[model samples]
Structures are given as structure tokens and as C-alpha cells.
Target chain A: MYAFEYFAPKNLQEATKAFNSFNDSKWLAGGMTLIPSMKLRMNAPSALIDLSSIEQLKGISIKNNILSIGAMTIHADVANSLDVINSLPALASLASGIGDPQVRNRGTIGGSIANNDPAADYPSAILGLKSKIITSKKEIDAGNFFNGFFSTSLDTDELIVKINFQIPESAIYLKFANPVSRYAIVGIFLSKYHDEVRVAVTGAASCVFRVNELEEGLFHDFCSSVVDKTDYGITNLNDDIHANSEYRRYLIKVMIKKAISILQKK
Target chain B: MRISLTINGNPVSEDVDNRTLLADFIRNTLGLTGTHVGCDTSQCGCCVVHLNGEAIKSCTMLAVAANNSEITTIEGLSNSEDLSAMQESFRRNHALQCGYCTPGVIMSAVDLLKNNPKPTEEEVRDALEGNLCRCTGYHNIIKAILDVSKAG
Candidate 1:
């Protein structure tokens, strides 16, 4: 890592100030991805505005039928939160399955979505549950937040405060995780709110995306049979060493089936 | 930058580079060699340490970020007189071969047991995913953690 000025801001205002004043500054959330990238010399920022000290950006709460999670809340905390587990066990389970215990202990939900790694799990949850991303400036719907692979609609100075997820009637996340890195080979999150059905797939594309065919099939008839009948085309899917595009398309159907089966039993 | 923290119950202060990793600060600056750095890519858990009571990979964290926080390394697990229960269990179960990954494995296991006192074998295995052990094939290490849980 290159030598840089580090500032641990106690509040969002100070963080924003540091970010605006610095030449090439980056907001350090959990530093799980940023530090590693810096160490690898892939990213070299002039200043690091650490947000760990900002008390306002750390918590989990539920109000108005929305599950609000602070941006800086570590994955371990989200995984073990009683409120999250009770209100949305699928989200808790998703947090718990990210990486390992050590990774969960340090990685934050905000950092995960901010980085917007194509293989990350949070984007799938955000899109599938139709969460609202509450930033320092405005609340962006999860559908509109993600732009493309490793990209988001967030401005450089715009800090994500928290994310608000509406509790779905039934939702579940299933992923075919890479054994070594534990990133998803093809992860799918399926959620049903009354007659509305949403299917978000991650790790099998350049960005987290929704499968309209499966969503429409499930919307018409919410069952494993409906998902099994749908054919998810391999066009525009990610083809990597872990899995080819055709294999990813197949896994998407399998994962959606698994999630539907799990939701059906719930 | 100058930073201060409580390490192994001792209050210490040091000046380090802004990019200094916590593992390097612990092993090089502080001379606490018990915390090993097997792989610096953050995949290997050889540098696992307790930061504010949570087991995190020290290599992935900047030393300055840990300022004002409470850290517990492998050396803090035991005094000069005797070894910690988890360490003792590893010794009794022959869970170590070259001992390169033992300190981190023990540190991770101790944290797991702290959270879930009586974790099952599968649970222990799942928790140990971050900590890699090539020599023992993980059979004895899993048994050692289970033995410690059963003994408690």
C-alpha cells in the first residue's frame, strides 16, 4: 500500500469534508476490499477517510415494516441480530454465509454494496427485496442504485447512511458458492410480496440482475414447477473459469428452484 | 501517524506509517511474533487477532485503524506459567504438525467457543474455514476443538 493520509472521522460531516478536500480520497468502510486492493497495488488513493468512528452509521433497526440496517454494520452483527433473524431470516442467513466468520467480523454491508463487486451477495438481496438505499443525500431504490459491473449510481462524495428493506411475505437466498473464495458462482435471491414476485441473480453476470421470465412465471403461479418450466437464456451471462455462461444459466434455474422450495416450506 | 491501543492488557503507543498492516505492527513494531502472517492476501487466517473482542484478519486491517481499540494476540491467550485451555486441548489432541497455523487456528477457535460454547463438529469446521491447516488434514484440529467444547 502506498503512503496516504488517514483520517478517522467521528461524524458524517467530517468525513464528507475530508473526502471533498482530498485529491484522490476514498471512504474507508470496513476496508475488507479497499485495503486488500491497496495492498495489491490495484488502488492507490491519496487519502483514506475511515468511517469506522462514525457512530451514526452503525446499527440495525425495524420500523414502519421496513428493516433498516446501518451502512457500517458488520456482516457478523447482521448475521446474528435477533431483529434481523426474526423479521428476515433470509437476510440474516445471507449475511452469515458471506465468506467466513473472520470476514464477516470485519466486512460491512455498506462497503459491500458500495464496492459493487459483481460476485457480492448484498446486491442480490438489495434487488430481490427491493430495498431502499438511504444515502447522505437521498434515498435511491435498490433497483436504480446498481448501474453496472463494479459500478453504482452513488457519487464520490455521497455516503450511504443505511438501507431500508421491506419485509417480504416470503423470501430466500441460495447461492452456489466458490469453495476457495466463497464468492457466489451463481447466487439467486427470490422474494414474494403478495402477488409481486422478484428474482435477483448475482455472480452469473457483470452485475446483479433480475430474471423477468422466472419472475413472471412465479408471479403467475408461485411454485417450483413454474420456475422449472422457465428457460433462462444464456445471453449476456458471465462466463468465467468457475462456470461457463451455459452452466450459469442452468445454475440460475436450480438456485431459483431451491429458493422457491425453501420459501414454500417456510 | 501516532496511534495508541491496549494490546494483551498493556497500554502501548507507537508511531507507524499510514499503510502499516496490523499484523506487521504486532509482529514487527511491537515484537509480538506469536501472530504469524502466512498469506497476506487476507484469504489465510494466520494473522487472526481479537480486535474489540472480534476475530479479524490483522493483515487486512491497517494498524492506524486499530488505534484506540483493544487487541488480543496469541501471546495474550496464555501467561508464562501455563497455556490456555484451547492451546492445551490442541497439544493433547496432537492437532499441530508444523505449528505454523496453530496460533491463528487456536485464536479463531477460542473466539468461536466464546460465541458458541458447545459448537458441534460441523459448526466448528464451518467456523474454521477462514483458518487454513495443510499438515494435519484438519481431523485432529476439529477433534481438538470438539474436545475443548466437551470438556467445558
Candidate 2:
């Protein structure tokens, strides 16, 4: 890793000031991804603004059918939190399925969403649950959050404060994890709400995306039979040594079917 | 950069370069070599340590970020009286052969049990999915964690 100045601000104001003044400064959330990228010389920043010490960026709160999670909330916290598990079991289950125990404990929801890794599991839930990301600047809808590849709509000076999710009637996240990396090769999130249903797919494309066809089918008939009869074209999904684009396309269908089946059984 | 944290029940302060990782701070600066760095990426859990009583890959964390945080490495799990329950289970069940991945495995196991003490065998396997081991097929390690949980 290259030499850089490190600043640990106790409050968000001080952190935001340091972040704005420092050239090429990167906010250190959980370091699950950034630290490794730095060690591999894949990234070089002039300064590191540590958000871990900033007390405001850590917790989970639920009220009025809305779950508000601090951006820095760790995966383990979400997986183990009673409020999350009881109110939003699908989200809790999704958090429990991320990486391994160690990764879950340290990796932050904010970091994962901010990085917007295509193979990440959180985006599927965020998109399917119609979550709202509250940043220092403005709130962004989950639909417009992800840009493409590893990109997002966030600007350089902005910091994500919290992510809010409205509790759906029923939701399930199904993932086919790559055995080696533990990343989702293909995952689907099925969220059923009043008169609306969202089907989001991850690990099958350059970014997590919603399956409009499946969404339409569920909109017409909110049942497994509806999704089972739906067709999703495999136009431009991800392809790698782990699985080919065709295989990933197949896995996406399978995951969507499985997620719907699970949701139906629930 | 100057960073201070309570590690393995000991408070230590050190001046370091901003690029120093929490893994290096624990191993090189504090001279606690038990925490090994495998991939230096979050991909490997060999450098896993407890930050505020939760297991996390130390290699991925910056040293300055851990300042004022309480950390527990594998070294802090036992005493002269006897090894911790998880450590003893690992030995009795032969959970490790080369022993390079034991510290991390034990750290993760302690964390798993702390949260879900009565985990089923499948849950145990699921909990260890992040910490990779090439030598063992994870049969004995899974058994070790279950045994400790059962005993406790």
C-alpha cells in the first residue's frame, strides 16, 4: 500500500470536512474490499478517512414498517439483529448468506452497496425491497442507485448515511454461490407487496438488475405459477471461468423459480 | 499515524505509516504473530480477529480505523490454566494438520458459538464457509466446533 494520511474523525462533520479537503481521499468503511485493493496496488489514495470511529454510522432501527439501517452497519449485525430477523427475515437471511463468518462480521452494508460489486448479494435485496439510500446530499431510490459495472450514482464528495427499506408482505433471496469465492454466481430476490412485486437479479449481469418479465408476471398474478410460466431472455449477463454466460442465464431462471417457490411455501 | 487500541486484553499505542494494516499492527508492531496474513485480501480469513467481539479479517482493516476499538486475537482465547473450549476441541478432534489455518478457524468458531451456540452441523459448516482450509475436508473441524458447543 502506498503512503497516505489517516484521519479518524469522531463525528460526521469533521470527517466530511477532511474528506472534502483531501485530494484523492477514500472513505474507509469496513475495508473488506478497499484494503485488499490497496495492498494489491489496484488503488492508490492520498488520504484515508476512517468512518469506523464515527459513532453515527453504526446501527439498525425499525419503525412504521420501515427498517432504517446505518450505512456502516456490518453484515454480521444485520444477520444477527433481532429487529432485522423478526421484521425482515429475508433481509436477515440474505445478510447471513454473504461471504463467510469473518467477512460478514467486518463487511459493512454501506461499503458493499457503495462499491456495487456485480456479484454482491445485497443489491438484489435492495432493488427488490425498494430500499432508499439516504446520503449526506440526498436520498436516492434503489432503482436509480446502481449505474453499471462497479459504478453507482454517488458522487465523490457524498457519503451514504443510512438505507431504509419498507417491509414487504413477503420476500425471499435465493443465491447460487460460487464455491471458491463464495460470491453469488446468480441470485434472485422476490419481493411481494400490496399490488406490486419486484424481482431483482444479481451476479448474472454487469450490475444487479430487475427482471421486468418476471415482475410483469407477478404483477398480473402474484403466484409461483405466474413466474414459472414467465420467460427471461439471456441477452447480456456475466460470463467467466466459474460459469459461462449461458449457464449464468440458466442459473438466474433457476434461482428465480427457487425464490418464488420458497416465498410461496412461506 | 499514531493508533491505539486494546488488543487481546492489552492496551497498546504505536506510531505507524498510514498504509499499515490492522493485521500488521497486531503482528509486527505488537509482536503478536498468531494472526497470520494469508491473501492480504478479505478473501482469506487467516488474519481474522475479533473487533468489538465480532470476527473480521484483520488484513482488510486499516490500523488507524481500529484505534480505541477492542480486539481479541486467537492468542487471547486461552490461558496457562487450560486452552479455551474451542482450542481444546480442535486438538482433541484433530481439526488441523498443518496448523496454519487453525488460529483463524478457532477465531471464527469462537465467534460462531458466541452468537449461535446451538448450531446444527449444517449451520457450523455454513459459518465456516468464509475461512478456507485446503488440508482438511472440514469434517473434523465441523465436528470440533459442534463438540465444543455441545459440551458448553
Query: Which parts of model 1 are misplaced by more than 4 Å?
Result: A231-234
Model 1 local distance difference test score: 0.93
Tens-place lDDT digits, model 2, residues A169-219: 989888899887778998888898887889998998899999888797777
Q: Candidate 2, which segments miss by more than 4 Å at Cα?
A: A228-234
The CAPRI category of model 2 is high
TM-score: model 1 vs. ground truth: 0.98
Please give the TM-score for the first chain of candidate 1.
0.97
Tell me candidate 1's TM-score on chain B.
Answer: 0.98
Instruction: Categorize the docking of model 1.
Output: high
Candidate 1 lDDT score at position A214: 75
TM-score, each model?
0.98, 0.95
